[model samples]
Target: MQTVNLGILAHVDAGKTSLTERLLHSTGVIDQLGSVDAGTTQTDTGEIERRRGITIRSAVTSFALRDRQVNLLDTPGHSDFVAEVERALGVLDAAILVLSAVEGVQPHSRRIMRILRSLRLPTLIFVNKIDRVGARTDELVADVRRLLTPAVAPLGTVHAPGTSGAAFRLYDPRSGGDANRLAEALAEHDDRLLAALVDDLPPDPSHLDEALRAQATAGQVHPLLFGSALSGAGVAELLDSIAALLPTSPSAEPEPRARVFAVERDAAGERVAYLRGYGGQFRTRQRVVAYRREPDGRFTATRGRITRLDLVGAAVDQAGPPGRAHGPTALTAGHIARVTGLTGVRLGDQLGSPAGLDGRSYFPAPTLELVVRPRDPARTLALHAALLDIADADPFLRTRVAPDGGTSVLLYGEVQREVLTATLAEVYGIETECGPGRLVHVERPTGVGAALEIIGHGFFGTVGFRVEPGTGVDYRLDVELGSLPLSFHKAIEAATRAALDQGRHGWPVTDIRVTLTHSGYWSPITTAGHFRDLAPYVLMQALAEAGTRVFEPCRRFEAEVPTDRLGPVTSYLVRLGARIDGTDQIASGWRIGGLLPVRVEPEAQRRLPDLSSGEALWSSAPGGDRPMSGDPPSRPRTDGNPFDRTEYLRFLAQPRNRS
Candidate 1:
């Protein structure tokens, strides 16, 4: 009768989808589980996802465990697909962070955890691949403590293979070896349970489970479960844990307000938004409010209503509440009710005033970016609209139309760029030519740049900035100006956001703060866009004279070989210009860490197959900038001449060799 929205997360190729299949199969959600290699997994639904054998989009499925309904969101593990993961987290009450028992914590895993911690979501760890050689649960737990989280504690054991071909009892917590650990860990979190244990009183397992679930939801402790999802050894126990420990969706909270996590257009040409309900129950034909565009650009608010609720095949309703109304469920991830009987509801629009309690406002700014151009100039406008639809569906995507008329969409990694390109052609009838992917960077001036007084079309004011590196990784903007009204000051804050949304590279800027030391407003006729245009120009002028630098992404690489391939690994690093930071000699091979430019990461992807002989783990991050040599940092580069949009398009159209 209750629902748990749980997202299964892991680093790419760490067997997340495999575990998902096993969960579906073992729980009887499906008669037979499909494999990733075979491309029949339910969660890998997109065309690109099937071909790539990776989850490019998030998929939702539901099953029953001990009378509770579990709605599982399987997200893409690659960094490029982090946008999907971010959206999934927004709707999820808890997470099951899957880690490779053989390899331990990875970069993408750490990134996912970073977001989980940022959102303050309760978490559980699933150490999978227990059947593989060198998959030591104890060592992996230690690694998780050292690298991921110290709060992670094991739940139970899964049997590994013995001398016989058949796997014996892997490891079960109830088998005395670690059966008492779950009880001890659960008791430590609850004072009453701890007292019961000390007084030699028999404690109820269900009561202890509820206490553990509360502790996990509060971010106090993250329980760990071990399994080999591919071998289906410990999957049943993992499903049981989900039923016992994960929190459930509220029955009747408030008005039906939902965060649209994903946007998908089905074969029927209807938009399907993956919705995470916050307060009220959303039913068919219920109207809601949507904020379509920013205030600066023809700001508009409209209304839309739900048309259909999607579910996963016949197995969906079996997990529903007793005597509940029966409905057809979309095979999409999460609770997605279609927007039908709508006139104006736009993407990223909140249905009602959001509740202030425990709600987060923003997602992580994108760390990667690409300049996209339509192969045909005639399709430019069409492509731009398509991108907006996509971005509306996925709030994590930040886009801005440059002054030159080129549109740049920020993505998290290479896979996203690929998916976008493929999707544009398939869904929108547009073939887009993409420039080389670049690490999205923010520029902060180091000194006082020029101050200019704006006396152009319906705007007037002098904006000054004594720019410098902000605390940690931010840009400090100090402004001095004439007197302005309090309402005008608020307008300046909104204008600063508009400026940050579209930086020089068509990417959203971050780590910067602006001071309205001097502020002013024109006649009431002047609108938000007037301030928006003037603000970015003034900020750009200030940044040009002040020094700016580029930031590259860093990677933590894990490689396993026959010990003979160590030299080859070094050779690969040298050729790729990656600097070695640390190395650990493992029992079978070695693990290494280094700093690598995110742009050239595709090479690491290709070489890892041969270098490790299919035994390698790779993860990387979008890192901060390093110091520039000699002179002060140069002016940040813009996309192209603002007056000539065609020039940039021409450049993008040319082949790399020709360029």
Candidate 2:
């Protein structure tokens, strides 16, 4: 039996957790079903998730199938918790992207597809909530093809059109009628399958399965499964599709490249990594070597014990060996193990699989930043340490301790800000005061600029360089070495990275190119720290020559509202400084699509629901750069009470200039 690692992802409140509960129930992993509204669901055991009625983080569960083990990860569908989903995809063998049959395609739904496509992950779409009245699976299926994929094909009809609360029967085009439709669709992906249909030769099950998996992973033949999570109709067949078609964990990998998707502190005050093994065998209590940092900021290889390994099914078991793990396991794909006393293991740390490769892609940069300060100034150091720990546990949550003195915690949204506040007050027992959280943005050179040259008189050394827009966002860098050996070019890149980190606006510079268009390294007499000391000054001096402009956060948004509300919606958009791109009538209402600036608080995406009387649907492409209006909006800083007038003013004074 093969083992598979799969993830369930959808927009917020799309019944992912409900579907997860049903999947577990049908698999016999649980004696009874659990409900998210009741807060009794297994995967949503996190206190934060239960209290908020939204998945603040991700959870894993596993069960058996046909003697095979399948591990399932349920990820938060909200755009704010995207970091968690991204990490999950890094380790997943396949993904089941959920869509609401009643609600149909959404902004976040498209965003998730883009992300999965980037990773080249095999995908299956489940059009859920089919049991609800007035759900149109046909139109929804059409939208999926138009918006997300031309390759999406309906698996089989579950709920009859215009019907609700009816018993669902699985369809197979291999049989007859609707099955023939599915067979015809399947034939488009494979010539042999088409030949089988023409010659009256029935296609074998394995051939269909293999073709679907290959095409799906290769961005073809997106299979859609319709189901009702509330009533559990069509769930069994959905499970069958996942079991029969999804690739299993440890399948098609040369060696293990495990990534730490989530991290939590054990009762003992040490960190434990939630690891997903992609291509290698894993054993409990085994020692693994990883690149980590020491207290003095030195990078070195450290050894750590696995401590315990959990294979999720029914209840998590401490499996001693790979062979002992369950096959066709349920919703969880990775193992949870406790480790302690290792100096530098971090949240996104890539651990070795006995094959020696460790480095992997780093997590995306944070999009929101706020200064975290303890109410009692005495706990400042403690607060600093705690934030560092959080950052260590989640690479995306970057924290920087300014040399001039202040600690800023980076996040993605208000939800993360709230979680940090709760964690600090409840978990750490520290009453913390947080500064106003603000949007995180990046800057790019609009025009070419030259690096400045300064001749060293004593403490100062002569250096020259140039900064310009780079070819791509991934490589916006600053180069400052006057001349370097081919072997030292990497070191120069490292030095430029150190400098690019904190631009004039104190944010990472992106999409901007820098060349030591010319530069002079410090003489032998100067200390090695000379590069560190001179790099910033040289960068700052170059800033004067090249000039600066701010880039504001922009979003691509889709807003749905009632047809009658179009006029009022346009009025609201005008007030919010948004420009419209197009408008169309959707199943529920009118959808206005366009780009909007991030500073437009009470943002249209957040307001459309209320504006439409809870009838509007909204979502945005996570983040991008746009034109800044010279004055950024002023919002209240909520880390503390809203009455802190001084804090409000300080937040208002934050640079409107993007970094």
Candidate 3:
């Protein structure tokens, strides 16, 4: 049987989990449907998810659709859990973007659509909750086209959509304006299909189906389907479309290569690495090399064996346990499963192959920082260990230990802070107090700068670098091949990355290009470690000369408030340094959107509730970095003159000094 990995994504309360349950039941995977409200859904297995009625983790389950095995990944809808969604996106073959029929398109929906487009993942849109009163499929379709893409083609139309048991007209190429438009769109992509249509020879159903599948897989077209996951309306038709339209997993290579997309702890506290086998097969007890590229352009590897393998949602009989094996067990390509005994495996790590898969930043840098202290200081080590586990699961939860032995965590927003606190208390039995939130900032080189350094203290080597602004958030490094041996390239790259991690202001540096313009090495005394140590000195000197620019995180925000309070809200937003993009009248009242510093977001949340009489809906997400608006604050530069050999040597002697 063929395999298809499908991801179900949506904003919160858009019935994403309910759709998963409906899909499972409609395909005979389960006898009865589970309820998200009742906390009985198969994918929402976590206690926190059950109580909150929201998915916090990405969960997987499988069922049979026709002759194909479909693996469904139900991801969290809340923006705070977007990191979870990013992890799942790397492994998905296709996606179903769920939208609420009554609410239309939302802010996060547009953000997710941009990500999906960037990944070039084929997608189908499902306007769910057609059973709800005031649900308008036509308006919702228009909203999707306006906000997301104009390439969307509706597969069906609804009749009396807001009523119970509404009727649907599934698209058939033989009739209707919608069907004709779909054909024309499909023909635009295929010359033969267009010629056939022009010759008065309508393409056969098989031909049209093949063309549709080809176009959809290439992301040239997106099919739109309307339904209510709660009532199971139009679900079977959706399934048929998926089975017929989406491409199956391609054949595996002779040598297996798999990407580990996620790592989690099972009930037994054993590390479980969830991987998608891109090629070949994985057998029990087979030794495999797990490797990942470090930021410094070095590949780190460890050897391990898969002690066990289990399908994600295998069923159980009266005599056997869940996820039982019926026969010889070996995970083949085009399958998703968990393996045990792979230690030191990180997210985005590749196994049993040297595919040179580069790591990708799925989410933006976290902006909120909080100092955490355990109630009992003695439990500090325990708190650290527990946080490590959480950080492993969500890479965005960056943790740092300060010089004073204080622990600080970088987060996306307040909700994540609350969730982390609750999870620590419940899972690890550790009580912790958190300090007030602060905004995290990053620094970048403003202009061209250069530096050259000669090692003197029993170390014989010289390194030089030219630094300049880089494109986007990339930290790019290039070496002159003639200046150094090929073997030393990795070391140089790694050292440069380490140097970039700390700017003069003690923040990570971004969007900088460093080129190794010159290098000289002498004998056995000169080693990679010497180069690593010498790198920071030259890089920091160059950064100081170039001058660093500090950037604060900004967010694009949208809020709907009563018309009577529009003036006050607009003035309040402006006072918070928000650049109002536009204001429009809506059914609820007035909708305003603008960009503002994330530092003021909490204040807006606190004040808006009272200002709007609790009738406001607001949303915001990271909107990239911008230079500080006013004159750049005077921050202390590196102490002493970097060009002074004596002073530089003394600075290097200090153990805590980056050099």
Candidate 4:
């Protein structure tokens, strides 16, 4: 059978999991339907997910749709877990972007669409929940066109929507306006269709169907389908559209390779990697090379043996501890399999070579950090280890353990913080107290500053660094790269970058130039640790004299609210430190555009409903940077206060701080 690695995406509470259940049941994958409210869904296997009635992790299940095997990846809908969605994006052949007919196009929906468009991923829009009380048809379609995209081909129209007996009817292309709509949409990209329409030739039904599939498969036009995943209204029609519109997985490649999109530890605590093979095969007990690229564009290759391998698919309960795979010795192209014994495997690792993989990120990492402490101080190490495990599964978290044993975590929003604390308690048996979230900022030097580390500092190495304002991280060696040894030179370079993680004001220092003016070490007693220890003290002191400015990430926003409510909305935005740039008179209201602090955007969105009497839509994009207003905020230092000489020496006295 053919394979379609399909991804279902949506904003939270949009019935995406319901849609997954409907698809599975209709295909005879299960005997009874699963309910999200009851926490009996097939994809939400974790205890917390079931209790909270939300998907916190991405889950996968396979079922037969017609003659094709659909590997459905059900991802988390919450914005805080968008990084999980980002990881799954690479393995998908086509995607169903779910939206609520009642809520219309939401901020997260728009964001997901923007990413899909950027990747040119073939997508189909499902306006679900047609039977819901406030579901809409025409007005919702208009919102999708204006906000999401203009190239949507409506597959059918709804009848008696928002009622239990709601029904959907596919368009009769030979009869009515559906033909005109499809032709017009395809005309922009299809010359033949454009010519036929221009010649006043309304093509036959088969011709229109052929044209629709071709355009949709190429990601030129999105096919729109309306349905209620709850009542199964229009779901069958939507399935037909999916099979008829979307493309299948790529043809096989002879070279042996697979890309790791997810990493999870099984019940036995063995690291298991979920990988999709692009070509060739990986068999049990076979050695494979994992190639991963760092943020700096350098690739690292590690080799490991696959002691165990299994194909990914569940027998009865698709949600039950995903990766409950069927024993399989080898995984070939177009197949997803879980393999164990790849000890050093990581998320996004390519098994083989990185030749054909794209290591570029579609989104930036979370820019907010919070210090978390274990309530029981004895469990601090355990909490840190648990956070490390979570970070392993979701690398975007960027968990850090301070030299003082303080733990900090990066997050996308407040929801993640709550979820994280609960997870640590329930899953990891660690109670925690989390500090307030702070925006991560960066610093750039205003002038030049230099410092030197001599033998008198009680270190075995002599190093000096001159710091100046520049673009990007520039490191030059005034002394020879091999003056002492290549190891010492590397230590100083790496330490310089690490030391810059926090500046004079506790923000990450970037966009600077640093030259190692001097370097020396005692013959054999002096190790790389000496230079590593010296590099930070010298660079940070230099940074202090240089004087740096802290800048926080800023959000560029645009909002639409009723004309009458514009005053209050404007005042509200201003209260949150927004700089209003312009306003234009739109059809239903005023379109306001401006920049707002990134941290305050969620609040603005939460308050928008009341401000505009529940008719306003707000959206923002992260861009640019603004000077942090008022007193500069300080982030929790993980370096044990290197600026103070006494603390620096005292911190190094501990065994854990030896590195």
lDDT of 2 at 54: 83
Ranking by lDDT: 4, 3, 2, 1
Weakest 10 consecutive residues, lDDT, candidate 3? 633-642
lDDT of 4 by residue, 1-659 (tens): 67889899999999899999999998888788999999999998878888888888888888877777789999999889877798899889999999999888887788889888887889999999999899999899888888888888888899999999888888888974678777887788878778878888776677788889988998989989898888898889988987788888999887888988877777787888988888988988999999987543447799999998887652434556664544445788777888899988878889977866666676666888888999999998899889988887787898777545768888988888888999889878898998777788888898999988886568999998899988667777798777789988888888888788888887778789998998888887899998888788888888888889988888888899999999999999999999999999989989999998787888998999999999997777666678876787776677767788778778787897786
Q: Name the top lDDT candidate.
A: 4
TM-score of 4: 0.91
Ten contiguous residues minimizing lDDT sum, candidate 4:
314-323
Q: Is candidate 1 or candidate 2 better by lDDT?
A: 2
Worst 10 residues of 1 by lDDT: 162-171
Q: Tens digit of lDDT per residue, candidate 1, span 1-659?
A: 56678889999988999988898888887898797988899888877788889987788877777867677889888876666776577678788999987778888788778777777787888887777777766677777876687666576555543211212232343344343455566665678767766776666656656666787777777888777787777676677667766677645454556666566667777766666666656666566665443422323456666676544323425568863435543222234344444433434454544442232433445755677888898887898898888776666676665434557777876667888889899878899987665566554435545435454433454444433444322332344323555555455556555555444444344444444444445666554444544555556555555544544445444445557777788779868877777777877677777766555577878887788788776665654444333533222334332223355335334564121
Q: What does candidate 2's lDDT look like per residue over 325-385, in tens digits?
A: 4443312224433334444676556666333333333234566778877888788888888
Model 4 misplaced stretches (Cα beyond 4 Å): 196-199, 313-328, 356-359, 402-405, 446-457, 464-481, 511-518, 565-568, 571-576, 602-615, 629-631, 643-650, 653-656
The whole-model C-alpha lDDT of candidate 2 against the native structure comes to 0.66
Off by over 4 Å in 1: 101-103, 114-120, 131-135, 160-219, 250-256, 291-302, 309-349, 356-364, 400-407, 445-620, 623-659
List TM-scores for all candidates, in order.
0.71, 0.77, 0.83, 0.91
Q: What overall lDDT, based on C-alpha atoms, would model 4 receive against the true structure?
A: 0.84
Of the two candidates 1 and 3, the one with more favorable lDDT, higher being better, is 3
lDDT of each: 0.63, 0.66, 0.80, 0.84
Per-residue lDDT tens digits for candidate 3, residues 1-659, read 88898999998888899999999999888899999889999989878789889998888889988888888999989888888897788889899999998888887788888888888788989989898898988778777876788778788889778889876678787664544567776887888778876886666666677788888888888888989988888898899889878877878878888878777778987988888888878877889998776544457888998898876644455576664755536677788888888867877788888684766665686777788889999999899888888887777788776444557888877778888888889888999989887778888888889888765643467888888888433444454566666556667777677656567676677778787766888766677766766777788888888888888889988899998989999999999888899998987799999898877888988999888999998977678777886654332234333344577667767887543
Query: Clash totals for all models, in order?
Result: 17, 31, 0, 1
